[model samples]
Target: MAEAASVTTTLYYYSIFTSPPDRSRTSSSSSVSVRRRNPSSLSWVLRCSTNTSFPWGCDTDSLENASALQKWLSKSGLPPQKMGIERVQVGERGLVALKNIRKGEKLLFVPPSLVISADSEWSCTEVGKVLKRNSVPDWPLLATYLISEASLMESSRWSSYISALPRQPYSLLYWTRSELDKYLVASQIRERAIERINDVAGTYNDLRLRIFSKYPHLFPLEVRLPAMDGNVALVPWADMLNHSCEVETFLDYDKSSQGVFYTTDKPYQPGEQVFISYGKKSNGELLLSYGFVPKEGTNPSDSVELSLSLNKSDKCYFEKSEALRKHGLSVSQQFPLQITGWPMELMAYAYLAVSPPDMRRNFEEMAAAASTRTTSTKDMRYPEVEEQALQFILDSCETSISKYTKFLQGIESLDLDVTSPKQINRISFLKQLAVDLCTSERRILFRTQYGKRPGPGSGRFTDGAEILRRSLRDMRNGELRALKILNGFRKLFK
Candidate 1:
């Protein structure tokens, strides 16, 4: 995700243009419109994108960047490898096996010298010295380092690597606020996306106020990559590997080789595409970080968020709010709901929300159980509020389903803003992505209600957890004493 931007017309266009070969960091004539010769290499796959259009990087379908990156890495001490970058069906462009890659065989011995980190030498010495002096974190430092090197073009050692980065990485960070609201209106993921965008904006503003404004010439607005994956570092050839929901292997330092590599969990034919795991990420998570959503039911870890709120009319509202606040929760909370199960914590929160005055004694305990911070879990059941808890969840599920139903039925009606063909294409593409995400998410909610429609006269409220005949227990985050996870997917069969 190298944002190789030079001076732009506006401060926030966030373009990824390659500057002139002159390597001047402050030249006004740096931003060019033509494409450069992309190098060959086993460059990593940058799974991110942008909403604001400016020609920054090449198309993912093209192999010019990959080829260039490969040549550079090969000459720069990269070991012989069984895989090389190729056009693929899964992640657009990914590492494909050049030979029979076997299960358990470690791959991609990307040398330590090639990996980019905070400690990597900056092309701009002044920028590096100033950033380190301020005690910047690893994420922003690496982002700044990559941007600085990128601005230097061929003069910088990482020129080939920078050239390989996607001009527009496809993360939710790039999605416009209006787009998120209109497209992802049905799911709670919209909230997460908004929060993430705000976080990036906030970070950018903070840095501009503290550092970038003072050294504008050295740091030319790298707002995209920093918010991405605080836990991650930029790996070389390993970045080319695309994510598969099935694969359990991930890129990590191999102490034996003193470099980064991932062991193959599954066998691949010579021509087959190689895959790696991003994490045990849900469909919503993949969409958040990487723009793509997994096809329906293919991702075993796929899940949707279900939001639950305290009944304001309840007499214990103030007390419950205080208790939840102490445990770092609020009156309204979100829990992940999967096709197979729901977390026990969801049940605990629901119970507390629906608990009557008679169960006042256990309010604190229930709130504590709901918090992930609670090390020793306390699983308590209130038979008196059990039915109420189950109904509460079903009601919430119904409410969510209605919103999805409204959007899915006539999604095109929401695209009235498009006047030009370009705008139409953009809006339509975004709509399709939204439809895919919403459909997958709504599918889970639909399964939970046992064919229950949104309004009154819907199907009979299905049992939840122990009380929820099968749905609640089916989707459990873990084993529960009274029931299992909410098997929301099972609702479809009914």
Candidate 2:
């Protein structure tokens, strides 16, 4: 959301992920044997079932473990200078400039020996071989690798790094189903979080059926099911760099240096915290993956999705639906709404939504523009249906805002389901994060419109942007940006 040059974490963005908290393993030099447990003991079957402290990993803010990781990396051939891990205001713990860092400086030359990828040697050779024999993907493979090494404790080379990882990573995947429904009931993010949770489950189920169930000796029942979270390739020192929406830098495999590195896009003074981008993510996306949200109005890239749907009873419903199908669109669609501008595809979809029977000829064109894959003209507009299209979007904006309002206003009265103090603390933390995310999402909707509740013929927007911009937050406190964009929308409407 912090609009700047963009990049992805090629050290690869590992979420605060999974595994069973309670388990015992005793290891020999050649292999680590895990004790078998019932399917009921598996944690991935219900990832966030526990609300209190999980015993799988150490505290996230453990500076002592962080200190040990630095020493281990130094001895393991990591060529690092200028930055060191330190407690920071932004991301709990992050890389801070040990000395003045130049804007274009290449930092953190983490060598291959120190890196963790799919090819990293497993503590148990047989376990690694079994996964590779099946050609398991990087995510699932690495997830299993983490839990395997973690179970070995001091016997595994990665003990310091694992100990530094938060026992409970602040991700939405760690939130229970009811927590999502209760706190985020009004937000579309609730649906996205549910889908992510299901994805982890589906991946686990697939692995269980195809691989784990076959090799109980290599991957005991508890280990296989609990070590199921995917989409991560852990890089020890490199991963210590916390995310900032403002920074445009990311870690990558530098071929010449034979290590992973991220070139700084902005200079840092000595003692200043260094930040890197975690891709261009929305407020909700950051929460879903990283379990943090940037403050409101700071992240320029933050946007809310506006859903537009076709009338079920419309006379042209079948024809419109068919046209949309050909263009890879559904009868209902969602378009992203940024504070600066909405997508051209949204404008086109809105035009399609309000088109009359006489204007049916334009259905395919509207649907085509709405599909991002379509190479055709993107800015086609109909002067006859212009006002109707703007009114339709205005109606959707107001409807979304009301839902956000209901949850935010009544948040204080929300009751907790937990009895213990620790569980209460966990739920309270999750609830506060939901409030931050929903508040940020709602602000974007408010930026677009404040017309009356949407209903048949929605006459509030009959006069168009004249009423629309006036209600789009009064723009008096030097909100010149909002006024500038509204003028563009006004011209588009006319």
Candidate 3:
């Protein structure tokens, strides 16, 4: 989503004053005192409040700062329209844009009502408390509350831009209903758990650890938007941009000064409503990272329903051999000889997962690599068939990839492992896995190109054709034999 823009004017506090009243009394007659100052001919009085009770006491300077902030918020102009509100009405109330636009243009200013520095030392708890105390009412969602209630508007320019407030990180603390009895207070712990699982805690812990180790920073400990400046929270006036694909604008910030800026990527004409992409930009790198296939026939104007988290049951792998073959590498393309697990361990998995043809090619290459690695390691007591084992393990890995990727890719195409924890509870995942393996075509790498017109003196395709047919027959027989062996093994285990 796009960020809010920086205002040209900077806020400054002048004087912290005491209200004209029985200053020491806790009666309702007490009032807050404030004074604001600026370099221009605009100097104003700001109000500072006191609780008048022992439970909530107000500081002198805080009152003064609040006063100054109030005056600044009051005098600021309206935002632009490219940043539309999700639920806010579009009458004479909110912001409006002054121009028309195309895709990727700056539509409005979205200032931060709450901004925390990227380098700040505050913890998630501190941030949450701050938001709870200072956040405004009327706007229920934090993202919306901070923007819609911050300021008043007059023209269309005011509607063009809104603000995004800073947020606290909230991790999903998982628990299972079956294991609730183990806790000190079963009902309370069960109520607190956002997700449920049938697996043992040890298993769950291992999965969580594996996920964190692979992608530590990728999962947010706290959910928050990057701020424009300072260690403060986003204000009420900004947060109006809704999700759209053919967006006109985006947010940018200055690292050193913490100032936020909004700029137009395209020209916005008067009266045209502005829009910004609410989801991550679709690029080659992002496509792989997120495992999002463009919904078939989806266009820029299509409505977005993005899933933000990764699915455990979906995994991805890469193909160094095919890529190398395409690039004319004969030695199995050693540099890209990479083994990535589910949740997209590295970038190559992204490229491999989206295209079925690519997936088929890469799986073959993985089989080859497994053979090579096993043969190389065999002198030491590795008794199992290396290639087959590795293929199973690779399939298992695919089952543990991110859920978000699965949602974006439309889960029907994944190669899942029924035994894996991620898919153990998912009937659809198991069903899809069976379908993929059963319906998939066999992979055949052409050692030499064939199926061409015979040369002038060529005989009726005798020796070469016979050899090719025999080789194909042998390959098919081997596959049948392997399937029988696997089926027998399963029956014996059962």
Report the alpha-carbon TM-score of model 1 versus the true structure.
0.80
**How close is each model in CA RMSD to the real structure?**
11.3, 12.2, 21.6
Residues 1-494, candidate 1: write the lDDT tens digits. 12434434122322121111111112133221111111111121232334422333465566898789888999999999998888888867878999998899988877768877666777667788888897676656665676566555677788887677665444555577788877888888889877765665676677778877787666655453333322234666776777777877765555444566767889999989888766676777767766678788888778788999998999999999998999999999998776655666777888899888888888898888778777644445676676668778899998999999999987978878669997787677678778888898888876655532111111112223342435345434234522333455455566
Name the weakest run of 10 consecutive residues (lDDT summed) in model 2. Answer: 34-43
lDDT measured at residue 449 in model 2 versus the true structure, 0 to 100: 67
Better of 1 and 3 by TM-score: 1
Candidates arranged by lDDT, highest first: 1, 2, 3
Off by over 4 Å in 1: 1-6, 9-55, 220-232, 416-419, 450-494
Q: Which 10-residue window in model 1 sums to the lowest lDDT?
A: 15-24
lDDT of 3 at 249: 43
> How many backbone clashes are present in model 3?
70
State candidate 3's TM-score: 0.27
Point to the candidate with the largest TM-score.
Answer: 1
By TM-score, the better pick of 1 and 2 is 1
Instruction: Rank by TM-score, highest first.
Output: 1, 2, 3
lDDT of 2 at 115: 69
